[model samples]
Target: MGNFLIVSAGQSLREALSVAENNGVDPKAVLDMLTTAPTLFPSPIYQGHGKRIVEDTQAAPFRQRKIPLKDVSLFTKTAQQVELSTPIAHLLSDLLRSDEARA
Candidate 1:
């Protein structure tokens, strides 16, 4: 799916856990309920972190977006540069690669 799936899923999961907690349901029970869904957790990938690739091309955008200046002191007169780490960088790269790509 187009990147937002993971973010929306996270928000939904947080809300679910909050509700469960409010009703005194154990958090582990909530995770157990999720694992029972065949479609979402068909395999054991949920038990551990999944391996993924990070190709040189994938890192290209980060290199291109690198800040030129070094970090300056808080009270210094010089302007400082800040770097951000986006969780959906790979998805963003795919989305921005073409002119006709739909979001």
Candidate 2:
């Protein structure tokens, strides 16, 4: 099984919650629905000269060019340069644990 799945940008939290409530789904189930559904908000892109675009495009085009999460490699030398936030650190730790478990 894959370690992670990319969600598109068409699903909304309200819709997810409604589905969960109607289906009596668990928290994980709700999370799975949210993760699998398209994103309701658009990702922001910053251009030079203080130009920015928000939700300007659909995620379908990008979704067509997905890379497996398992293939993501840490920059061994420069990973330390990134600020370690609680959530990001936890995700990295989880990925490492998943890899070790698979091995």
Find the candidate with the highest TM-score and give its number: 1
Model 2: per-residue lDDT, tens digit, 17-73? Answer: 446656876534444433443643222211110011112222221222223223223
Which stretches of candidate 2 lie above 4 Å from their native place? 1-40, 43-72, 75-77, 81-90, 99-103
**How does each model score on lDDT?**
0.35, 0.32
lDDT for position 31 in model 2: 44
Lowest summed lDDT window (length 10), candidate 2:
45-54
Q: How many backbone clashes does candidate 2 have?
A: 7
Candidate 1 has its poorest 10 consecutive residues by lDDT at 66-75
lDDT of 1 by residue, 1-103 (tens): 3223332233345445557767898755665666555645433432221111012222321122212111111112221233434444433333333312331
Candidate 1 is scored at a TM of 0.36
